[model samples]
Target chain A: MACMNEDGQWIVLMGLLTALGLFFLALIINQSALVGQTTAEGVLEFPKNDIRDLRSEIFDVYDSYGTLHAQGRLGDVEEDIIRISLERKNAVVHFGNDTPQDVSGRDLHPVTIHYNNGVTEYDEIVYY
Target chain B: MVNDSGQLYTMEGVAAGVIMLLTAYIVISTTSIYTPGDTHIPDMQLEQLGSDVLAMMDTPDREGGTSQLVGFVKNGTETCGGNDLRNEFLTNCKMRAGDEDTKLRAQVYLSYRRTDGTVNTTPLSLPDPEFTGRENAVRVTRWVQLDGILPGIPDIEHSSRPRAVLVEVLLWRA
Candidate 1:
């Protein structure tokens, strides 16, 4: 076969380059959509609200410990929290409060709360 | 007479047309993939808003006090009124930047453990007859500590003792 004129072959090369560029752009866009999906899934899975709600509930237990109708039944309430969290939420939760001590001119209990599900683990010591 | 010099330009033009169509197809298909991912964004938003509302409800208006949720749910029906709780919750959820939102509705339930080590869930509010029970509804739950003998729950202690309970709310559009 005889070779034809090669004068405008750069047009074909430029078209090839443009096609490569578009392909990469599509790849990046697809990857970005994946990133967005994972970010939303991560926020949903982290259980931030669950942990916060658990902490507040623990504080309420302490508030009701020696007063109201629950006087002298703190242990049973604590058990209630642990068992329920494990059973319903599929999370292990443990919390305890130390004796009240004077801090900043007021008595405060040092409370430690720990929570762990399969994915997220959180622990905190809060004064109340 | 047949002309041949213009054939190169014709070939390039055809090549350009093909590339443009291919590019458009690729772009459109890639963006379609994005819509499926975008669905999660709305769920994320609803879940976050539901969580924030529940947390705010659990917060006491005054320092060193039980929130309205605790007060209304206390002791399993002593001070807790289902109507009052639902009204309070709806009011909080409906607040918006513009006209008061009228589209949100909620149903409340309480879950506690029985003596047999099983959990029982009871309604804290009357079930809305209009609820269609959409799967898109977001469920937000908070922990409530009750300090009296719960009477309605089956297989639990009848003595006046403190216990932990879960307050769950299903929020959805009307």
Candidate 2:
């Protein structure tokens, strides 16, 4: 009877400890689910405005291609894009327009644009 | 001393109460709830799609002819012919890489500086009937530098000089 008296107390303590451990484990699992979902959600929310603004600036340079290239100002614009991308956006960007080629009856310049922002990378060879 | 036989039952009751309290608190606190409106992910996706469609339409397939977007802006009048712009926008937006269709609607507006050097907005596309003042919409804008006067709708009397007009399209999904 003396052994039984203290033995049941130990059993109740052990059961309580196990219950607490399971509760903690469940909490950890609940939080881990959120971590994965937020990561994928962030990727889905792409920096679309940034890409659009970059494309617009590139085309703006293209629009003034003749004067800017002749004045060597195009080099400065390109350098600005690369430098700012590295400093502010944490991206590496490079774009170039090849010699004009005939595509479907129009003399269009083939522009190759490469953009990588660590998380996402986009490459395009669009005719403009 | 009195027999402590009921002490074990009292301890059991306390233990069960503590466990129940803890589980109730944890369950209430950790109920992970999510709503689509809480996250701006859908809005971001729709905005990106709208901007991409506008950019593509602005780009001329060839060098000489006017871009579809520019032509639409130049020829557009108040309350007329915006249907074409809306239709063309939907046509491009609905075409996905996997040929999936998205249900989206848009209202287009043009922002320009008048001769008095003030900005003005004129509607190019009418809003849909479903736009009952509560739908969430995103506005996508593009700059279109017009070389000549906007042909129709003499509300502000624009000059023949080059005007940099902004094409703002308010897009929403049904």
Candidate 3:
């Protein structure tokens, strides 16, 4: 009687372990399937507005410079504007009117413009 | 008596193990093989629309001048023709009528190059449309404007001047 009871308990224990293992396996599989579906859906939605925003910010910087030129607060009238370039996201405004006196006087000027992206950079020139 | 009970219990354990194994196998196989259907539209249409708008700006009538581009994509089930799309774009972008009475929503701004050798920038604002004409669609609008600067500085003046033109493009589903 004792031996029979011991064998019965062992069999029940094995059955219980098997059931638990299968349950965990099913859970893992279901979670993986859900993740895969979400990733695929996100890929299809092309965010067009994001691209447009970046392009717009680039133009905003240009408009600010144009406004300053029309205002006449930038430099001397007779001074010839040499090369104007936007480098390192900063505006590089060069002038041909740099006199020896102006260079020695350390009158180098700097102006900062704020773009739509909140990027602020200075426009400066080095006299030769 | 003991032998008979032991055999019965052993058989029950084997049956349970078999059931568990089969369930685990089914789960694993289905999880690995299943895939969602493809539903994403490519960028070809949008790119083409942008190019066409850019081409229009180069026309003598349009004259690639300084201007802003703004519009939005409406979500609905309706198909939009050229005229309808243009009207919607103009309304959302806040474009004005040109001398020829052409409702101009998208504008191009010409400006000097930045220090990085790229063109200067303008600010853009996009408005959403009230009515979406297509299902699962989104409205996108952009407003672009030239940047202004301080006066009297020749370098700064020329730098701030419009050199390269900005072309704003708007599009919708056909």
Candidate 4:
């Protein structure tokens, strides 16, 4: 009888120990999941710079305007001025009376270039 | 008769031993205990904070028909009175007007754990456009580290444990 009682006590102790170990294992897993969630969320918050190149292109166009003004090749200074404006899907460059008379074809200086869609047009307006 | 008394004593001893073992396990597990398999709690906290900061950076503020990225950090204030962790964090952020260009302002808060197990909080304002500007905000990028250890956790000599989280916010206004 004494031996049986001792064995029973040992079995109960072993069972308690196992239960505690399992509990800790579960806690560790829960903590891991929480950490994973945070890391994933942080990864999503990072910013992207897709428009940087486009902005630089716009600046280049502005710089070209300055260069054209400095060069004497442009004739009829009063009427050949060009102004660029951005529309919904295209960049419109309005040509004044000062525009070059020989301007034509792909060789014509394009004041505006549509980035999203491939469309380019020069509008000439002569003010009386 | 002697056999019965001895059995009872043995049973009591075993019961007491088991109870003590369980109590010790609970105490160790609950307090000042570090396990190799435990998850990186500080890393997780930093990650969450980084996300909140990024989200604030992404938000657009409208002024004079132009949308701008405006971020303000206020500490110990109820600016963003909400229960969400992100909102709570924002509420602690403060923004101040300084210099000729208000668009180039930044508010930063630093939190460090002290030796007495208390948190020491500090507020810092970045020099106008020093850390970020309209260009930086427009081109802001973010990256996070995924290692077992966390950055700035108390008293564990694992400083180089690749557990540091970094949040970079670019400021831009158009």
Highest TM-score model number: 1
Question: Ten-residue segment with the worst summed lDDT in candidate 2 chain A?
Answer: A1-10
Residue B46 in model 2: lDDT: 80
- The lDDT leader among the candidates is 1
Minimum summed lDDT over a 10-residue window in model 4 chain A is located at A76-85
DockQ values for all predictions? 0.29, 0.06, 0.08, 0.02
Candidate 1 lDDT by residue in tens digits, A1-128: 13665565557656766776677667667666675678778888889889878887787777765673335667777777888888778999999988988899999999999999989999998889
**Cα lDDT, all candidates:** 0.75, 0.70, 0.37, 0.34
**How good is the docking of model 4, by CAPRI class?**
incorrect
Candidate closest to the true structure, highest DockQ: 1
lDDT by residue (tens digit), candidate 4, B50-81? 44455454344643221111122211122321
Native-to-model Cα distance after best TM-score fit, residue A75 in candidate 3, in Å: 20
Interface RMSD of 1: 5.8
Query: C-alpha displacement of B144 in model 1, angstroms?
Result: 1.5
Residues B1-174 of candidate 3 have per-residue lDDT tens digits of: 224446666778777776777777666766544433322222333343444443333223444443222111111112332234445444543333543324233322222344444344332223334324343332232322333342321233344433222223434332
RMSD of each: 5.7, 9.9, 14.6, 22.0
Off by over 4 Å in 4: A1-128, B1-7, B35-39, B63-174
Model 3 - which docking category? incorrect
| Alpha carbon lDDT at A37, candidate 1 | 78
For every candidate, what share of the true interface contacts is present? 0.48, 0.01, 0.08, 0.00
Report the candidate with higher TM-score, 1 versus 4: 1
Candidate 2 deviant stretches above 4 angstroms? A1-51, A54-128, B1-38, B78-80, B97-102
lDDT of 4 by residue, A6-67 (tens): 44554665676677667766775555445344544443332112122233323333334444
